[model samples]
Target: MPEKIIVAGVPVDTRHFIGGRRVASPDTFDDVSPIDGQVLGPIARGGPAEAEAAIAAAREAFPAWAATPRAERARILHAVADGVEKRIEELSAVETHDNGALLRSHRRGVMPRVAHNFRFFADWLLTLGHDDFETRGHTNHVSWDPAGPCVLITPWNAPLMLATWKVAPALAAGNTVVLKPAEWSPLTASLLADIATEAGLPAGVLNVVQGYGAEIGDALTSHPDVRRISFTGSVPTATRIAASAAANLTPLSLELGGKSPLLVFADADLDLAVDLAVEQYDNAGQVCLAATRILVEESVAEEFTRRFEEKASALVQGDPREEATDLGPTIHTRQLEKIDGFVQRALAAGARAVIGGHRRDGQYYAPTLLTDVAQDSEIVQEEVFGPVLTLQTFADEEEAVRLANDTRFGLAATLATGDRERADRVTARLIAGTVWVNCFFVRDLQAPFGGSRLSGVGREGGTWSFDFYCDLKNTVTAPNGWNNHG
Candidate 1:
């Protein structure tokens, strides 16, 4: 077994994984569990030196790993998937302990998706095709060349799943990676490094550096040797990373903040609409793509609000380990305070909370719903990444579309309509990168996934992932040329 440390009575490896080994940091920081405000363990505190070491390791390993056969790479990724599947329960519990998300959510969907992320990209690599065409008596061959060392900065909301979402494609593309998980949730990332090593991934192919972004993020992002970066986090942080990478001319794929909208038409089913609305409270409304700004048709706004209030109020909030729990605590006390501040400001600005709008205890923020909010208010315009939903009424489809597109964010949107024609028409008019009709959060790995406008910088999924992680090169060969010398 890898080096282990006791965290909240469980053995965990909190050391940095560099150069295919568990390395200790000279300094350490307390990793507090958000569930109960207790110190779980001491996480390795990595700084510029650690970052440089990991980058050098990835740089040293890149060429050999890139030269490996695609078949062997696929097999190793499959083995990693199998290892993740075997530890689903352990990972689920550990994630809940680390980030205060519901364990059931992790076990049921999140962890399983982590495994699938690796498996899907692994299989995708084998089936990936290149273009070869003959033009003007010359053959043009297109190839996807692996980029060098990459940096993946993942969020605390869905740590391992989102990390592997980038990691799988980067590794499958035959590039070395150094992952920097959010400070609030770093245990699962350490676990993932171990899993990848056990699955026969080559030494230095994947490294984990643990610390706050302020301490080590710049060192990784601004490194001249780092070729690409994929970050999933807040807009402010993404902005800083972009600035750092700009100095090196390093390419970046950013999946940032969202204040997305959900439109409910009068012709839609009330129960289904209400069900979808309540689903936003999952993970305490920390989901970036969640339909938090709900726009309901005036005809059914009253009924929808009534049903939504009841469901949101009835959601059981307690320990994530319990199977009966529907919602868990926010990631930390600071985040909880931020959520409360947004609700308080909205209330002072004349909005009414029909359900909940306060912090419950510890790190738990009550699921909140606000009505009569102004279109230009901060609560409506800013991303309140907590268990808060804002509702607005629209006179018609025109007003609904206008209201949904009012914000600068264009990450995602959801629409509920019975008519196919109306769905297509409104979906076309929506400014979001992803628009769901009569459904929400149903994702296919093969589809293009990302944001537009201020929500993100580039896309990631299927070919789009490879497009960012690899360099596309074209080679032209002379076809039976008579004269070679000119």
Candidate 2:
């Protein structure tokens, strides 16, 4: 039986909310489950007008929200955590239907993290500060303040959690938001806005506008009123948003896709390494920092490949709502083709598919694992953003390092080893913004998270994210240097 879900206390329809009002537009799009082509709902398309309304609403609410003390902001955020808990099961079900994120993962991984994001930022908000210094000769201090109302665009992958990473901190820092969710999964974002409202957040403080990025996103980015734009999406789209925002001088932060590599040495714990690599490529490998490229030592290459292929094959592939399902489908029809193209390119470039490498319909790309993948292949160089895991063997420490850094992306990487020395050495050589030793995807909202190189600019989570969302308003202690009042 298909599970029915609701958003914002209202059932799904082609109609979408524009500025907290139920508005119907002739433009409508289907919300299909990636697991299959099941239509959960047909969502309405929002255009520039809706985007402008959302911006206006956020702008109207910005002053008071920004003026509110950190504690008050924290209070609201805390309430959001509480509110989300109430609907956790419903949210999980919707996630399975909308984006095809595994329900069990939603229960275990996504929801708790989403809740923690608010609570984490809430804690940070309660103790906001900037680094300062006092010397014998003079005093120097640096601080930050909210940038203003912002435009945040999040991807379909990890929608609620990643969106919270942007929205939680932005809201906690006193900046209002005009959030444009991915077309594939706007329901959750709508629910978040409703949850905030239910939590007593002032109207327009955290506005959600549902629409196509072409219409809504462009308007929000190009709007004169929007002060900052924080986005998590494709490199192409992010570049466009960055360029458009540059026209108005609105500061921006981004977290783009990744072809993150996992380096496993012969000296590494085989069990742990295999597990970490699998974990990195989990979520049907639909993660930004997923270990799409696996680099292992030539010594353990044969054995590791055997073990990994067996383990990777064991991953359950079926309906996301089922507890037994380990992997779900990609976001929608578009990505199915995109991921398929990448797979064909990899095969054409001489990489061998050691395990699963196919798609069912246009949604569920099989949990794939490719081996003997050349470093120069697209699978190694670009972000596949699917359940595909491509493996390449490395000769030694130098070769391992070389293979890991070969990609254009520098989002994150996982290094597995029992040897602390090797771990330290690899950690130094790894090019990513975040390095995980013996683990994968261990994220804490209190810490800075982002990427280097083409992966992205600036950071998210921790105070580092707020730094981008704000500017330092210096309050120099202007000392009277003798006889000002002559």
Candidate 3:
């Protein structure tokens, strides 16, 4: 039996973080751990009132934070990064315990990336400047100004990292923010609020409201004081947010769902292709950018499927606290059933499973790979968001592109090929926001990140993120003796 490890010493209060203090709500809900379906603790369940409070706090803080010198903001962001780094281990543990994510993944991958997000945006803030143009008769200046009070809603898949993805850039661009984390994964986010306060972030600069989206999502999106909203979640929810934002005519950015593709060409490195297929099983396929559709050339399809099956089956799905576990349980029972249903439907449609076609335990679904699935089948077309990969073979590059681009989502895609020219050509034709030629999940913090089509609207990361959190302000100065009719 594996030794059970429980996270201790961290405050388990799941209250809202407003104005640098923890505030409790009249009502609350239990946070159940997916690991064994036990109640971890009760979390303050917030509603419109909580949302209003957070937005008001941010509204009050916007002017001072926006007016602070760029260098000063950069310094404070670095301190926030430092605080996260110092408490990295505990923070990762809290995330693992709350989200049922693998311990190693949070400790090494997500936590460090969260810290990097802060530092990257802090460095980018230093390079921000006003553009000046002196023409024959007049001078013009263009500058970036904070978007005032903003609402940042992040998903639960990688809570801290995704939160930082939105928060760091918004703050770096001088916007005071109200963050609404997914209720399923709120522990790390609540902790991050305390960490940021300790790092010298002023009161009301950053507030976290923890509750269900149905309760407070509209409140945040439709509030008149909110200048912008950045969201990452499902398409249906995004549509609702869009509608709410429209009521106030507020600016918005959304990174929504994806049913991404991973194409393997006949001329590609076979070993590398197999490796990449197995890698998509990471985070138990809960990632938005995960390659759920595997499109392989007919010639190498058999070999690739064999190797990929071996690797996928070998992945350990055990206790998240266990060091050797490669994958953890799904975020909740509903997710586990959803993935299981997809595999069952595919099987019913005559698809063959090479391995793993059943759920193991509480919130634990086996790493599944389906072959011979029809191109238009529900499993192949929709986002499974689980540890399931469906394979389909194509005869040529054109067919492969056709099969890959069939989905409404164009968030991310990956292709494996040794030829640089082919790689470049195929990637250009691929309808994805981000395409990887020979790699998987190799990200640069400075690159613009988001999807096209239904995947997302607008972008984040690098200067793109800064621009989203701010509005461009332009000024014109006329010459001393200028006339309107001149």
* Winning candidate number (TM-score): 1
Q: What is the TM-score of each candidate against the true structure?
A: 0.98, 0.93, 0.96
> Local error of candidate 2 at 151, Å?
0.1
Clash pairs for candidate 1: none
Residue 343 alpha-carbon offset, candidate 3, angstroms: 1.3
Colliding residue pairs in candidate 2: 284-387
lDDT tens per residue, model 1, 72-166: 99999999999999999889888999998998889999999999999999999998877689889799998889999999999999999999999
lDDT (CA) per prediction: 0.92, 0.81, 0.88
When 1 and 3 are scored with TM-score, the better candidate is 1
Give lDDT: candidate 2, residue 197.
79
lDDT of 3 by residue, 267-333 (tens): 9999999999999988888999999899999999999988887777778888998999988999988
Candidate with top lDDT is 1
Q: In candidate 2, where is summed lDDT lowest over 10 consecutive residues?
A: 1-10
TM-score of 1: 0.98
Task: Quote the lDDT for 461 in model 2.
Answer: 73
Candidate 3 error regions (>4 Å):
1-7, 479-486
